[model samples]
Target: MAGEIPRAQPPPAEPDPVRDAHPYVLLWQWRRNPLRRRTDRLRAWIALGLALFVLLAAPAAMYAVGDTVHRHYRSTAEHEARTRDQRPAVLVHDAPRHPEPGSDEARETRYPVEVRFTGPDGAVRTGTTDVEPGLPADSTVLVWVDAAGEITGPPLTADEIRSRTMGWALLAFLGVVLAGLAAHGVAGLVLHRRNLAGWDAAWADTARRWTRAP
Candidate 1:
């Protein structure tokens, strides 16, 4: 018996109280073990912070972004409307009489047509733009232009502004989530590596006694 190898003993069984409880019960580590490591406490605090941010800060950030975008776009729309003018022009030729099935006109409900309009500079300009289908030659159409006789885009409408605001809000929310996830992920990785190193050091010290031969 003196020279024989000792067999490993089974570890004591742990209590199973609340084994089926939800995993998110608050302060679980602190309550379960008074001697929990600093890393564990730090992780708990980080989780609590992230949860609070998701509930309160995320929505606030999204709304702020959306409001800012709406205001900017609205201002731009008002400025453009003030600077630009929509003038009535005569169609040089008729839009396509008919479009093939599933064609651009059929999809968009508009077809390209050539039109002539006089700008504020007293110069006539001819250009092609989309208009509703089935208009005959010499038909009156509206075109937007600046003072320089150059065709320009129409001012943003209410529907477009609302759509853009929603899009920016969604983007802002996603950005917050992505940033939070990245930060938490890095913290978790650092904590994991620290835990591994701690375990290795503990095992190295504890193993000496078991390996020592009497």
Candidate 2:
């Protein structure tokens, strides 16, 4: 081994104790790094935009649905009432049928009978009238019929139905909006955590490569 050409033994393999430790070190390093700080700020902006979008869109969507429902109910109630008022009264010869198995055969004539009317648009409507039921047939009374020979019931007000429907729609919309917001917030948090983890791993890889060179 003196000058004859000393046999070179390979350098002992160094155990990479820092390999596993590097990830934690890089995570800490990234927390203090300016570039990562900028990314955090950007994420904050994205979250803010998402919140603003929900706030702005929810009310508008709710308004549109409410408006449509209100219009439908209003038109339906008004058309029903108008049709009922125009229906011609007819006379019937029958006895009133009481719920009781056997009741008195009362032949009382009265004005205004409730009748159901079908509009030209095929919408079924109900309205009450002061038409009288005439005659008696087997203890069953015949009430006045409309021009179309349909029974009419109590009329509903357009405004009342629209108001009630609108209120319920608003409540449902609010519930959906709240649920969406909660989901969005959770998603944002999960994204932020994943991004942070990725950044840490990348930093550790770069540091390890640089240290091993030369």
Per lDDT, the best of the predicted structures is: 1
Q: What lDDT would candidate 1 get against the real structure?
A: 0.78
RMSD of 1: 5.4
lDDT of 2 by residue, 97-183 (tens): 434433343333444444444444456655444432442422222233333545556356766886777786787578668866786
Report the alpha-carbon TM-score of model 1 versus the true structure.
Answer: 0.75
The 10-residue segment with the lowest total lDDT in model 2: 135-144
lDDT of 1 by residue, 42-69 (tens): 8768877886777777788899999999
Q: How many clashes would you count in candidate 2?
A: 23
Q: What lDDT score is found at residue 167 in candidate 1?
A: 96
Q: For all the candidates, what are their Cα RMSDs to the real structure?
A: 5.4, 14.3
